[model samples]
Target: MTLDRRTFLGTAAVATLAAPMVRAQGKPKVVVIGGGAGGATAARYIAKDSDGAIDVTLVEPTRKYYTCFFSNLYIGGFRDLASIGHTYGTLASDYGINVVHDWAVGVDRDAMTVTLTGGDTLPYDKLILSPGIDFVDGAVPGWDITAQNAMPHAYKAGSQSELLKAQVEAMPEGGLYAMVAPPNPYRCPPGPYERISMVAHVLKQTNPSAKILIVDPKQSFSKQALFEEGWQKHYGGMVERIGPDFGGANVSVNPDEMTVDIDGAVEKVDVCNVIPAMKAGRIAELAGVTDGNWAPVNASDMSTKADPDVYVLGDASAQGDMPKSGFSANSQAKVCANAVRGALTGSRVFPAKYANTCWSLIDENDGVKVGATYEATPDKIAKVDGFISQTGEDADLRKATYEESVGWYAGITADMFG
Candidate 1:
C-alpha cells in the first residue's frame, strides 16, 4: 500500500491487522458531506484504505475548498488567497471516488438516503457529516447573514477573508477597527485573537495611527497571555479589549450605521468584524443527529451517539478537549475512516488517538502555538498531554514555529485532496 507524507504520519502511529473482508453481493456505500478538512480527509482515507472495497461519494457545494485555518495570515498579508484554496479533482481522478458538487439538503435516516438540492437522492450504508459550523439565530441582535457583507465574519475563509482585508485597507487614517469575538466552543479557540494580531500587523504598516478595539464576552481566551504580550511589544497602545466586566457580553450592531453597541455604550467604528455564537452546520440538525448545537460522538470511532451508521467529525462533533481546528478535523478523519472501513469491509480497526495544533502569527517572524494529545475513553476524547509556546520566547524559536505551520499546511492539504 502507498501513503502520502500526511497519511504516513497519521497511520504510522497505529498498529493494525488486515482481515479479509467478506463481500456479500456489492460494495458498501459511504456518503460524506462537506469538503473541508474533516470531510475531505475522511473521503480520501476511506477510499485509499478500502482499496476499491467500498463505494465512496463526497458531497460538497464548492469546487474549491478554502481553509478557515491560517486565513488570518491571508488578512495580515502572509499568504495569498490562492494558496489556501484546494480542489477535489485529485480525489476524483486519482482515488476513483465519486465526487458530487451539490448541497446536501436532506438526510433520511430510516431510508438511509441523502437528498441534494439538485433533486437527486443518494443511498448510503454509512454517512459522515463534517459540515463545519453555522451561526445561531439571534446570536448577535440586529446581525444576520444578510448583514455579513458590512460586518464580515471572515470565519469561513475565502471571499470573506478577502473582503475583510480589503475593508481594513480602505479604512481612513486613525479609524477605529472593532471586533466582536465569539464565545467558547466556537471554531478555533484562538482564531479571533490571531485575527487581531494579523489586523494589527496590517494597520501598523498602512494606517499606523488606527486603533483596534475588541469586544469579547469571555473573561479569558486561549493564549491570552501570549497574545497580550505580543500586542504590547509589537503594537503597544494600539489595541484595547473590553471583557465581560466591561459589558462586552452584551452587544448589538447596526451594519448600516457601522456602529457597535456594547453594554448600551455605542461605539462608532470604520469597520466591524462580527463573529457571533455558532453551532453545527444546518445539515447536522437536519439529519437528526445533533443535540441542539453539536453532535455527540463516540470517542473511539467518532460515530454519532444518535446513530451508529452516522459519524460526525471536526467542529460539528462534541469531542471533548480538542479545539475545533483544521488539524483537529484532519486528525479525527483518519480515526473515523479506520472505523468505518472496518465496519463495512471488515478491515482492521485500531484504537482511536487524536492530536491538534493551532499556530498563530503575531508579527513578522513571530509565532505562537497550542496543542494537545488525546486518547479515547468510554466517555469522550480525553486529553492526555499538551504543549504551548511560552510568553517570552526568543525570536528564533517563534520564527521556527511559524515555518513549521507553513509546512504542516502544505502536507495536510495533500493528505486531504489526494
Candidate 2:
C-alpha cells in the first residue's frame, strides 16, 4: 500500500498511541467548527494535552484543507498547488479527535449543541468557532458569488487560485489586468498587494507590455511603500494603483462584459480579480456570535463576547492588534486551547500572549514582512511592539526574509496537521 503523507503520519502516530480513550466514560466535550489553522490547532492541543480528560471533535466540510498563506506563491509560479494542501488524518487518528467532514449549519446555544446539515445534533461542553470569512452580499456591485467564476476572488485559496492563475496566464500581450482590492479589516492586510506583486512578476516575464491596475477603496494599505518600491524595481511602469479619492470608491464589475465601472468611468480589462468585502463565515452568524461583520471575543482567551463557552478565532474574530493571517490564527489557537483546558480541568492558565508575522513574497527570493507581539488587555488585544520590512532593503536581507517564510510554511503546517 502506498501511504500518502497524511496516511503515513496518522498510521505512524497511531501505532504508538499511549493515551487511553475516555469518550465512552463521558469526558468533557469540546467541539471545534472549521478545520483551518485556529480550529485544527485548538482541537489537537485540547486532545493531546488533556490525557483523555476531554473529548475533542472538529467539524469541517472540506476533506482537503488549503492554507491561504503562501497561496499567492502558487499563483506566482513559486509553488505547486499540491504543496499547500493538507489533510485531517493526523488530527483524527493521531490525536484521538473526532474529525467530522460535515457542515455545521446551526448552533443551539441553549441546548449546548450544534446542528449539522445532515440532521445530526452534537452536544458539547465548550465550542470553538473558527469558520473564517464570507463575502458580504452585494458588497461588489454586479459581482457576487455567482460571478466568481468569471471574476475570481481567489481569496479562499484553492481552485480559485488556479483559476486566477490561468486567467492571468492566458491574457494576451499588452493586455490589461485589474484587481478590486477589499476594504479595511479583511483577511491578510498585505494579501492583495502581495497578489498584485505576484501577478506583475508573471506578467513581467510573459508580457512586459501588459498593464496591472489596483482599484483600492482605501487611500493607503499595508506595507504600501515597500510594495510600491518592489513594483518599481522588478516590474517598472507596468503597475498602477488608484485610491478611493480617484474613483476607486464607486466601482462595479460586469463579469460578462469583462468591464469595470469606477465612479461612472468604465474600463474594459482582459482579466479581473474582484475581492469583495467579507465578514465572519455563515456558521458564525448561525451560531449567533457575530456583532456586526465579525465576532467579538474577549482578549484574554478568545471567548466570544456573546457566550463564554463559545470562542471565535482567526479571520472571523475581531480581536485587536492582530492581522487576519494564518500565523495570528495559530497563535490564538494555542492561547484558546490553554484557556479551555484550564476551564475544564482546573489546569493552570497563563496570561494570554500572542504574536503574528505576515510575510509577502515580492519576487523570487525577495520578501517583506510585518509583525508584532501582543498582550491581552481589558478591552482588546493591544500591540506591545511591532516591526516591518523597511523600504529599500538590500537583496541579501530580502532573500533571507523569503527563506524565513519558506521555513515558516513547513513548520506551521506541521504544527497544525501533525
Candidate 3:
C-alpha cells in the first residue's frame, strides 16, 4: 500500500489489473470528490486526455465555486465577488466531463464504489479525493461551526466572505477587528495575514480610527517581514500582531460577548475572524484514508499510503514540502491526472514535476510571493529551488508581481473549469 517513487512510476504495468468493470463498453470509471482546485483540475485533465476512453465523474455540492485564492482581494475592494466565482458548465460542455452537484458521503474500497447523499452509488476504478479543509473541534474554546455567523472565519469564501466584509463595514468607529490565526501546516500560510492587510485597507479608507489585531499561534509566519513592512508603511499605527511570545497561542473567543481571551486577559472586539486549527475535509476522514489528520500521499502520483487505488490531492494530502495553496493543488492535480490516466490506459506517463507559488497582496499594486519547484524522490516531494520577494523592493517590481498574480488567476481558473 506504500507507494514509493518506483512503484508509482510503474503504475502502467498495473493498468490491466482493474477488474469488475462497471461500464458496458469496458470504459474505466474515475470518481472524483470535491470540485476545487485539485479535484476540478484532475477531473478535467483525465477526461481531456483520455478522449472517451474513461468515465470521469466529479462530485461537488456547490453550483458556483468561489476560489479562496483571491477572496482577500474581494474584501479589499480590488475585485468583486462575482469575479472570484466560477461555474462548471464549461468543464462539462467543453471537456466532456460529468460534473455532479452533490455531496459524496461514503467510499466503499472493497466494492470500488462511492456513495452519494442522494442514495446513488458510483463505482470507480480510480478515486480522487480533494476535499479542502474543516476546522478542528475544540481547537478554539467556546467557538465552533455554530458560531461562524457571529465570528466569521471567511476561510472558505463565498457567503462567509460576504458576511465577514459586511461585519467589518458595520463596525463602530475606532472599534477593534481581531483575527485568531491558525497554526502551522494549515492551508495558505500567508492567507490570514493578507486578509489582515485587506481589512486594514478597508478601514483606512472608511473607518480610519478602527484598529486591527492579529493573534497568532506560530512564532513566525510566511512573508512576515514583507507584511510587517507593508503594515507599517501603508496603515501605520492601525495594525498590531501578537505572536506566541505574548500569549497568542492560548486564546479563546466568546461569540456572544464579542470578546477574546488571550492568556486570561479579555479584550472586547467588534468583529472576530477565528481561523481555528484545520484538518482534511470530513469526507477524507469518512473515506478512511486519513492518518488521523491528513492522508499521506505518494510523491510521484499522489496515491494515498492507505490504498493505491485512492489518491488524495490539495489541502487534504500531506505531501512533504508543499504548502497547501491553489497553485500547489493545481500542480499536484496535473501530476495525479497524468498518473491516473496512464494507470487506467496504456498512455505515456511522464516523470512527475511539481511547483507552487503563493502570492499575497498587501495593498493595491503591492504584492509578494514565495514558491518552490519540487521533484518526486523515494522519500517525498523534494524541494529543488525556491524564491521570495525581498524587503525594500521598488514599487514597479511589486506592481508587476501583483499584475502577474492577476494573469495567473485567469489562467488557472480557465485551466480548472475549461
Candidate 4:
C-alpha cells in the first residue's frame, strides 16, 4: 500500500506489482489525484520545495494533456496540436515525482488510502484532489456520449477539439454552427464565447458565408462588451447571440438530427457544440467530497470542508469569485501546495493571494484579456483591481496581446508539468 521513492522508481518496469513495501523515512506520502493544471503544478511544486521531505505521487490516466487555454487558436488553425499537448515524462524524470497512470476510484478516509480502478489501494499521509470538472449527463436531453460523437464539445481540449475542427472544416459555406453555453459557476466562464469567436474566425477563412449562433442560459457573460465589439467589427452578420430572454436558448440538444431546441423553437445546424452543466470529477463525488456538484473547500488552503487531510483545487472545488480557468487552477495549486507543505511540516500557513487572467482570441491576430487578484473573506471571494482590454484598442495592441497570450500558455504549461 505504501511506496517509497526507490521502490516506486525501480518498479517502473513492473508497475502492476502490488508487493508490500517498507515506508520511506522522514517523508510524508502525498498522493495527488488528477494531472491537469492543478494536480500537475501541485505535484511539481511539492516535490521541489519539500526537498526529500515528502514523497509525491501523481495519479492520472493520461500521459499527455492537451490544454484548453489556447485551443481556440487550434480551432482557428493558428496553432498545431503539438504546440498545446504536454507530457508527464518531464515531471517524472526531472522532478523526482512518481507519476502513476491510474484512475482513482475511491478514497477511504478511515484508512487514509486511495483506491485505484485496478483494485490497488495506495496509502497516503495527505491527498490532493484536482480531478477537474465532468459534464452533467441528462443536463440536456437526447445528448450523451454517443450524441457527442456528431456534436462535439471540445471542452476537454483533446480528441473533442479535433472532432469539432473536423466538423468546421466539412461544413458548407452557408452552414450554421450552433453552440450552447452553460450557466455560470461552470468551468471557464468566457470559454464558450471564446470558442464561438474562434469558430467564427475559421468561418471567415474557409466558409465566409457560415453563420454562428450562441445559445446561452444566462443574460450576461464574462467580457461581454469586448466580445460583442470584436464579433461585430470582425464577424458581423455571421454571429448571433440569444440569451435567456430569447427563450433560455441554452438547454437541450437533439444530436441525431443535428437540431437544438431553444425554449420552444427548434433550429437545425450543421454542427453543434453542447457544453452541458458541469460538476466536480467523478472521483470527488465518489469520495463524498462534494456537496451537490462542487467540492466545498476553504479558500485559504483549498482543503475540503468534509475532509481535513484532502485538498481540492481547480474546477472541482467551489472557489468563490474564481472562474474555473487554467490560470485560476494554477494559482490555487501553488497556494494548496504551500498549505499542504506547511501542514505536514508544522509550519505557519500564511494568508493566500490568488490571481487569474483569461485571454480570449477574436481572431488569430486579435486577443483580449481579463485578470484579477483576490483575498478570501469569510463569506465570499472579493476581487481586487484588474482591467479588461480597453474598448476599441488599436489593432497593433490587440495583436500584441494575442502574442502575449501564446507566451503565457507556454510559460504556464512549463510551470505546471515541466
Candidate 5:
C-alpha cells in the first residue's frame, strides 16, 4: 500500500496496527465540504490517518484553489496567479480521496447527508464543514454582486483578486485607490494592511504620483506600528489612513455610481475595494450550525455545538483570540482530524499544540510576522509561550524572513494538498 505525504504525516504519529486488523467490514464515511485551507486539510488527514479504514469524500466547486496568504504578492507583481493557484488532482490521484467537483447546495443534518446543487445527496457518518466566509450583503449598504463588478472586493481569492489587480494596473498615474477595511472578526486580521503595503510597492515603481487611502472603521489595527513605520520609511506621503476618529469614514457606498458617502461627505474614486463585513459561509446557516456570523464549536476538538459528530474549522469556526488566517485554519484542521480519528477508532486523543505564523510584506524585501502557539481549554483557545518573531533587529534578518515566507507557502500548501 502506497501513502502520500499528507497520509504519511497523519499516520506517522500514530502507533501501528496490523493492516488487516485496522480494516473494518464497513468503514465510517466522512464527507467534507469546501476544499480551501481547512476542509482540504481535514479531508486529507482523515483519509490518510485511517490507513484505508475510512471512506473520505471532498466536495468543492473549484478544481483549483488560490490562497489569499500570498495574493498580495500577486497584486504587487511579485508572483503569478499560477504560482498561487493549486489543484486537488494530487489529492485524488495519490491519496484515494473521492474528490467531487460540485457545489453543496444544502445540508440535511437530520439525515446526515449533504445535498448537491445537481440533486445528488451524499450520506456521511461524520461531516466536516469548513466553507470559509462570505461577505455580509447589507454590512455596507449599496454594495452587492453587481456593484462588485465596478468596485472589486478581491477578498474571496480568485477572480476578484484578478479584477482588482487589473483595475490597479489600469489606473492613471495620479489617480487615487481607496480600500474600505471591514470590521473585526473578518478573515486575516493583518490582510488589509499587507494589501496596502503591496499596492504601495507597485505604485512606487509604476504610478508614483498615485496615492492609496485606507478608510478604516477602527483606530488601531493589527501590526499598526510596524506598518506605519514601513509606510513612512518606504512609501512616505503616498499612503493615507483615515480611522474612526475622522468620523469613522464609515460610509454607505453606491457601487453603481462608484461613489462612497463617508460621514455625510460623498467622494468618488477611480478604484475602490470595499471589503464588507463577513460571516461563515452560507452552508453554515443552512445546516443550522451558526450563531450570528460564526459557527460555535468546542475548542478542544472543533466539533460544532449543535452537533458533536460535525466538526467545523477554518474561518467559519469561532476560535477566540486566534485571528482567522490560513495558518491557523490548517492547525485547527489537524486537531479536528485527530479528534475525529479518536472518536472513530476509540483511541485516546492527547492534548494538541496549535501554532500559527502569518507573514506580511512591508515591501519587496522587508516583512513582518506574528506567530503564537495555543493550548485549548474547555471553552476557549489560550495562547502558550515561545511564539514570537524577530523584531526590527537587522536588515539581513528581514530579507531572510521575506525569503522564508515563500518556503512557508510551499510547505503549507504541501501539507494541506500533497
Candidate 6:
C-alpha cells in the first residue's frame, strides 16, 4: 500500500498529537546526510509524521537520484536511463522539507552541527546518515576510480551505469567481458549475479558469440544455485565463473591493456567491471561513528553506537542480518523515524520490527527472490523468519515474482520520494 503522507501525518492515531508539542529545542531539527532509500525515507517520514512539529533537512549533492536497485535492468535493455532518475521536488514542496543540494563535509558531535561544502553549518537535534558505500582504496590491484572510464564498476548507479551499458553495446563481435566480484557484506548481495544475468541477456541478443567471465573472491554467493541454473538454461557455454578455489581470489587487472591476471594467467578483455571491497561513505567516517569499514548501530532505532543523537542507515550501517538492500534500508528508516519522532515529540514508540525482500531477474519473465522478517536484539537485528525462491520454479511463478518486484519498485520509490 502507498503511504499517503498527508493522511499518515494527520490521522495516524499518534498519542503525542493529543498533548502539547514538546521538542528538545524549538522544532527539533533533523538533518539527514545522503538521499538514497534510507535517508530519503527517514527525512520524509519524520517531516510528514510530525506535521510541522519537526524541522527536517536533507543533504544530497545530486539534484537527481538514480536508484542502484534496478540499474542493471537498464543495462540489460529492459529500461531507459531517464526512467530511474528521481527529483527531490516533491520532498521539498509536498513534505515541507528543506532539500539542500550540497556535500556534507564534516560533522561536529560536540556542537551537534554539520558543516557543508558551501561553508554553511546546519544544527540538528538528531542526525541520520545514509551515505551508502565507497570502495576501499587499492582493494583491487591496478584498478581505481581514475580507470573507471575504461573499466566501470557502475555500482553507484548513475553515469557509470550508462557508461557500462555503452561499453557493452560497443563491444566487438565475440569480445570478452570480465567482472571482478566483491567479497562478502557488500551492498546488494545478489547484485553482481543479477548484473551478470543482464549482461548475458544483452550479449545473447546483440553479440551472440561474446564470452562472459566472472572472477569471484568468494566460493559461494547469494542465490548461487538459482543463478547457476539460469545461466545453464539461458546462456549455456557463454558464461564462465572462476571461484577462489580456481584462483579467483588471486586476481589483478590492467585497464590500459584490457587484461585480467588470474593466478599469473592473463586473459585479455574488451570491458571490465571491478567491484572492490567497500566501506561506509566518507561522511560516516568524518562523523567518527565508523568502526573501521562501517558504522555500528542499535538495530532498534538505527542509532549509532558511538552517539545516541546520531543514526546510521542503509549500506553504511553495520546492522546485523540485513543484507544492505534498498528494502532493508527503507524498513530500517521507518523504525528510525518512529524512534526519532518519539524522542522529539513524545509520540508513542512502537517495538522495532523490520523486513526486507530482494528480487533478481535471470531472464525475461524469470525472477527469483529472497526475503526475511527481523527483530532487534541486544546484539543485532536477528532474523526471525525467511524464505527464498527455488531453482526450477514454474514460468508463471517466476513471472509473478518479477511482476511483484515491479510493483515493489513503484511502491518504494513513492514511499521514499513522496
Record all residue pairs in model 5 with backbone atoms less than 3 Å apart, i.e. clashing.
Answer: none
Worst 10 residues of 4 by lDDT: 12-21
TM-score of each: 0.97, 0.94, 0.94, 0.92, 0.94, 0.96
Task: Provide the global lDDT of candidate 6 against the true structure.
Answer: 0.92
Q: What's model 1's lDDT at 118?
A: 99
Ranking by lDDT: 1, 6, 3, 2, 4, 5
Residue ranges of candidate 6 with Cα displaced over 4 Å: 1-19
lDDT of 5 at 19: 36
Can you write out model 3's per-residue Cα lDDT over 1-418, one digit (the tens) per residue?
2223344233312222222323456899999999999999999888877776788999999999999999999999999999999999988898888889999999989999999999999999999999999889999998999999999999998999999999998999999999999998899999999999999999999999999999999999999999999999999999998889998999999999999999998999999999999999988899899988899999999999999999999999999999999989988998999889888786777788898889999999999999899999987888999999999999999988998888778777877887
RMSD of each: 2.4, 5.0, 5.9, 7.5, 3.6, 2.6
- Give the 10-residue window scoring lowest on summed lDDT in candidate 2: 8-17
Per-residue lDDT of candidate 2, residues 1-418 (tens digit): 2223454234223111234433455688999999998999888888887876898999999999988998999999999999999999988889999999999999999999999999989999899999999999998999989999899999998999999999999999999999999998899999999999999999988988999999999989999999999999999999999999999989999999999999999999999999999999999998888986999999999999999999999999988889999989989998999888888876767788898888999999889899999999999999999999999889999988987788777777887888
Query: Where does candidate 4 stray beyond 4 Å?
Result: 1-26
lDDT against the true structure, each candidate: 0.92, 0.90, 0.90, 0.84, 0.83, 0.92
Between candidates 3 and 4, the one scoring higher on lDDT is 3
The 10-residue segment of model 6 with minimum total lDDT is: 7-16
Top candidate, metric TM-score: 1
Tens digits of per-residue lDDT, candidate 6, 1-418, equal 2223443333322233433457554778999999999999999988887888889999999999999999999999888889889999999999999999999999999999999999999999999999999999998899998999899999999999999999999999999999999998899999999999999999999999999999999979999999999999999999999999999999999999999999999999999999999999999999999998999999889999999999999999998999999989988988999899988888878888898889999999998999999999989999999999997899999988887788777778888898
Error of 1 at 2 (Å): 23
**Count of clashes, each model:** 0, 0, 0, 0, 0, 0
Model 4 error, position 58 (Å): 0.2
Q: C-alpha displacement of 238 in model 6, angstroms?
A: 0.8
| Superposed model 3: Cα runs more than 4 Å off | 1-25
